[model samples]
Target: MDMVISNLQQQRAVTEQLRREAAIKRMLVSQAVADIVKFINEHEQDDCLLHGFTSQRINPFREKSSCTLI
Candidate 1:
């Protein structure tokens, strides 16, 4: 009976340890996701600023008109 109780206690301790590790991992993942979101927002703003330098017009292929003043 004593051996059985000892085994049960050890199993309980191991289970508690695993639970704590899992909680810590979950917390770290949550923090990482938040950081990624912040970084993506900043990157998107940077791209918006860069878009101003890009082309803003598309020329038509056929365009020839002239006015003569005689």
Candidate 2:
């Protein structure tokens, strides 16, 4: 009877350790996902700025040719 009680206590300790490890792993994964989303949002804003600048630079050339015909 004493041996059985000791075995049960050991099993409970192991199960608690596994649960704590799983919780830590879940938190780490959630943080990584948040960081990735933040990076993508920043990159998209940078891309929009670059596109706008390029379009503005090309517009003057287009306007000059069109105005000569007017």
Among the numbered candidates, top lDDT falls to 2
- lDDT tens readout by residue for model 2, 1-70: 9999999999999999999988873458789999999998889866644456456554543545344453
Which residue ranges in model 1 land beyond 4 Å of their true spot? 26-70
lDDT (10s digit) by residue, model 1, range 1-70: 9999999999999999999988873458789999999998889855635454334343333355689899
Computed on alpha carbons, the lDDT of every model, listed in order, comes to 0.74, 0.76
Q: Estimate each model's TM-score.
A: 0.36, 0.36
Clashing pairs in 2: none
Task: Locate the minimum summed-lDDT window of 10 residues in model 2.
Answer: 61-70
Q: Please give the distance, in angstroms, between residue 53's alpha carbon in candidate 2 and its true position after superposition.
A: 46
Q: Report the error of model 1 at residue 66, Å.
A: 96
